[model samples]
Target: MQSPAAPATPATPATPATPAGNAGGIDPIVALPARALSQEIHARRLSSREVMTAYLDHIARVNPAVNAIVALRERDELLKEADACDAALAQGRPAGWLHGMPQAPKDLAATRGIRTTLGSPIFRDNVPAADAIVVGRARAAGAVLIGKTNTPEFGLGSHTFNPVYGATRNPYDTSRSAGGSSGGAAAALATRMLPVADGSDFGGSLRNPAGFCNVYGMRPSAGRVPYGPGPELFLPQLGCEGPMARTVADLALLLATQSGADPRAPQALPGDPELAALTPASVEAALAADLKGKRVAWLGDWNGYLPMEAGILALCEDALKAFPAFGVDVEAITPPFSPERLWQIWLTHRHFLVGHNLLPHYRNPTRRALLKPEAIWEIEGALKLSATDLHAASVERSAWYQALLGVFARFDYIAVPTAQVFPFDVNETWPKQIAGRAMDTYHRWMEVVCPWTLSGCPVISLPVGFGAQGLPMGMQLIGRPRGDLAVLRLARAYEQERDWVGQHPPRALL
Candidate 1:
């Protein structure tokens, strides 16, 4: 791979002035969110064409080294989109929430007329005739689709490399990873290849990569964002499409634009509370309210399936202490279910879904060769699951839910480390030996993320602060089921108090 150009020098915490390199020329717009950029365009400070050209130019310059963007649309098409936005502005029309913003979609999500490779050689030239639900929503909100980002094959792993697109390197340290299958999205946002990007999370796909890239990511409550065009769409309710951005407000804006009830997903509505109104101020107010008398629990490590890296636990514990500052009584608590059993259930369910859904492709040796072994393992595990096994897992899952209910009855929220370790090397797969124990499966190393997945609770991964490595470490704020606003409110409060927003990857120096 070619070496990436050195990033520009680090700027101060305040939004840096548009670079002097951009003088009368469209230099790449780095680190700004879609909403903010759109506001600038509405104010006539920048033209949509200039923003598009800046991002397109940046992609051309850096995408070769990072391999983040898998496809770039014709400049004409992007220009057309820009012209539409400009015409709207000319008519004195108010722009939509994301009007005139250029964004990239994770390659796994279908994009109309654009190659959506799913990071596999099998679909190297595949293009969907229709947009995925989220993509359609983004477009309707007036987001200009600049390109598709990279992902692992079938989004089966946490690392983004595949036969179709090469590995996406971390912008912070080229030698480290940008985390996957949203690695490409994270890298692009970190390097300012695009103002903001979209990502989907099955198991930390959004949160993990955001933590790795030092951006903000939220995994909304399942059914909060509709995902579809599949027979068993509701089966894997744990997964959902989510937004990734450089600031808490940007993420909230994207969520507002994309979230709502779909007839296809009857349960995905935003409830009585308005999600769009969530801001750092509201979150701080909620954090300040009733914490003095509220109960809080912290899970330092989950049943030892994966060992906590030395500083990770300390970092999380320190963040948890802030709950007390908000007036909540805090204590370390353990859930009722076994971590191993949770992993087994996740593997069985995920494998079964992938195996049956993708049977035709797996039957072909050529296609199967491109499938990740972990994906194959999931399929095999699913095939072996009996009705009894599934029912038993469901029972255990219910018991785990009950355990959470018990905890919530005593405490308002549960806090845990988002990942056992900070960002690892970009070239390696997940750590094989987490705490000296041989991790038997890809899901084992990510045990903490799954417990909340099974419980179907709304969780937000908030950047607590940088770890000893100078890489960001996040704390998972698991709120009551359907407590999306409350969780986001808490995240906002933490973000305000700590002011960790706008922290950029060192590579942005280039």
Candidate 2:
């Protein structure tokens, strides 16, 4: 999988001219995608402080070459909350379906007084007195938080570097790797800097940084996006928290505003309790989900027990052979358990939930050298597990979830490849090897996103293109175990047959 280095012609960056009242007057308002700039900020024709000062002037021209909006917050307190959302749209009132937009969240999402750094240096000057029911449902669906992003520490790793806000990179190519525990929300929605962000996954941190920053995340369907305060008998759906954008209708308008039902989240997912009132025609009916005659299996590398990197399985096999020329059948197949039994039931349920959530930072001996030797080998490998190795990994995860519900009762969708190698070298922290094999652990080069994070089901990464070092390459999909809106209508029918989120990365990372 390591063949990349030959393609260099991208360096884009020279547009800095359109300032006076920006937003949907577009002019690179970070290439407009949050549902067409939320219908031009709900047809007030854009003036939530001109789309929050054109996303703080495109994060001061591309967030210092992709650090991915780390702690941010005060741009005069986000232009006085976009001037109280343009005086609540000049008192005609009723606005919020992400009304004024401008979010950030996902420094492990907790934001009330903001500064919630889970990119840990002992929560680096913490904060968060509240919020985090998906940031209070993305601020009751009006968005506008404006800071946080970057992660890794408590979000263990996919690679968004951390010791309290450090590495993010890869806006197609800063040095590489944008993938992580939502690598700064997939490098801040791949350079849009934040139109829609928020993320979390477990073994692919929101599908390997939305396939290493091309964009589109979604890990859903484990009680469809709910999350909570702490470990109330953890490990039910091997970690979740969703949404990241650059389209699939702005990731189903931030997954219908981070989904619903949260009696302090006892496995959440009550969703469609009017999906906590998300509108814009239910996000254009979950972005016109179609996929023609639907069938689709195409499991790119699992049969080889995943070593991948033949140029990311030839750009996920040219996007599953362009979904059988869009009539959609596809079908390469390979899922009845064994990427060594889904990596031993994802390393005994993710190292016993990373040793009960970081064994109090490895028994705090001065925060034990700020953890991370793969969190002290997953907290001493879940203190050497063995309840007969978690009942033989819970009887091989219930016969690998009834052999993936018998391959979704004859395949309606499975797919794979959200990353096995493409965006490496952000000063290298993981991938000790891919094509030549060897990576024994440090997230075994992401066991093809830990078998859909142990198949709680509903996955998604998207972006399928570019790789001979020109970077980007996504894929994944999965669905049908609750099938979060049938895996977002087959990823909005292969994102309306490959719009690839309207391309855009090399405006020189700006």
Candidate 3:
């Protein structure tokens, strides 16, 4: 495996942690949640090397079962880097909050000197000269980049599989999928192989995987986290990079690290001036938040417009009962925009963006052969679109945004199932049908997540618990546009009120 280049300037590490203390009885550092782990490292309770070694050992023992992490750096190299962190800590230099943590970014993200295959064989040996914005921010925050997490080919699907690293199996059910683009990251977080992970979302790449793996993943508002230090900065802003974690607090901390504007990304959203006071204990809004009498609209199956599998919607509905218990009023209300319009808007944007994004490779006969069928489909569909089609879709998209704004005027949050179906068989490429409704497109089964994507709002996927078949599912809590912190706080409150967030999956228990 290729080792990423060291940081241009070394970050001063925090005060040295005692490597031998297990006073809390959590001797194995891998067992700690990211928030607790971060605090322990900076408070001198655990050394960077100790955390790195524990993680390495755990990864060796567990990663083979699910194949969540790939292109891992050799053990000696990582330990040596951890040692450097410890040495710098002794010198009394304080690093960023993520000082001693280990992170494996999604495969779609480029890492300096490390292979970033994008789940395609074409880039199997491609080593990048620089990191993507997500990876660079994490590095600047003092995280040790261990390697890349798995994703579908070019991150085109929601199931993590590519010729490069193969499919990532669900940690809870090895025969089932872990969900994708961010699938591998979710699996890694669920199994305790990574303290936290990062991923991107276009059509629920971040949400689906987290739900399938029974972890937390958020798709922050578009531009909130800046998509790139790459070309194509403009147009196709449907997807944005965001954080994934075992808990909401860790998600907030990561969001803070990943947020903030960059001149390189001209369309990026500005950082919150009030974010300086953020803490893991309370991932709240600037003003104090109150749940009393807050209105939440549940768009369950879009009022039967969406064909969800039998058990998925029930799980989401049951999860909503907790909100009302907290003085929140939950209502089953249909959005003013029909499901078909939302699907059309989502499809149009995908065709335009994905077509332009992948046309270069498709134009090359050899490269085109390596592209996935879905990639080809997106490109061809895009070619069939005209400037008129895009204009009409863009116009409709603005109306859809207004429709959502109207919903927000009456509701505090919008709710939906994160996925139409639970984790399917690992060998199957995608669900061909949901609740007997034939899926017309490769991503049709995921239409449930597209509304939030099209709206460019902040949505968090929370575990709704396992289905009758024992496979896990997730519920989406959609907050207002650019309301990243509000949705995060709601998820934080849900994590505390409900008992689902910390329940370990099968692998974590073992």
Name the best candidate (by TM-score). 3
lDDT of each: 0.72, 0.76, 0.83
If the candidates were sorted by their lDDT against the true structure, best first, what order would they fall in? 3, 2, 1
Instruction: Please give, for residues 373-410, the per-residue lDDT of candidate 1 as tens digits.
Output: 87777777767788887788788778778877888887
Question: CA lDDT of 411 in candidate 3?
Answer: 86
lDDT of 3 by residue, 1-510 (tens): 111122233322111121222212333688677878877887778889999999998888889999999999999999988888777777776477778789999989999988999999999999999999989999887899999899999888888888889989998788899999899999998878898899999989999999998889999988899898777878859878999998788888888889989998999889985553565444434323677877788878766788887777767766776776667778877558977887888888999998888999999999999998999999999999999999999999999999889999988998888999989999989999988889999899888889888888999999887776667789999998888888887887787776464643444335
Judge candidate 3 against the unseen true structure and give its global Cα lDDT, from 0 to 1: 0.83
> In order, what is each prediction's RMSD in angstroms?
6.9, 20.5, 9.6
Consecutive 10-residue window with the lowest summed lDDT within model 2: 11-20
Best by lDDT: 3
State every prediction's TM-score relative to the real structure: 0.88, 0.34, 0.93
Q: Write the per-residue lDDT of candidate 2 for residues 1-510, one digit (tens) a residue.
A: 111122134322122222222322334655677777777777788878888887888788778887888788778888998889889877877456678888888888788897987888888998978887888888877878888888878888788888677888877678877878878878877667677887888887888888777778888878778887665624546888888787776777678778877788877767774344556656666446446777877777766777887667666666665565556776676557667777878888888877767788788788978787888888888999978988888888888888888988887878778878888889888889987879988888888778777768888889886666567768888878876776776777677767654644543352
Clashing pairs for model 3 are 158-180
Question: Higher-TM-score candidate among 2 and 3?
Answer: 3
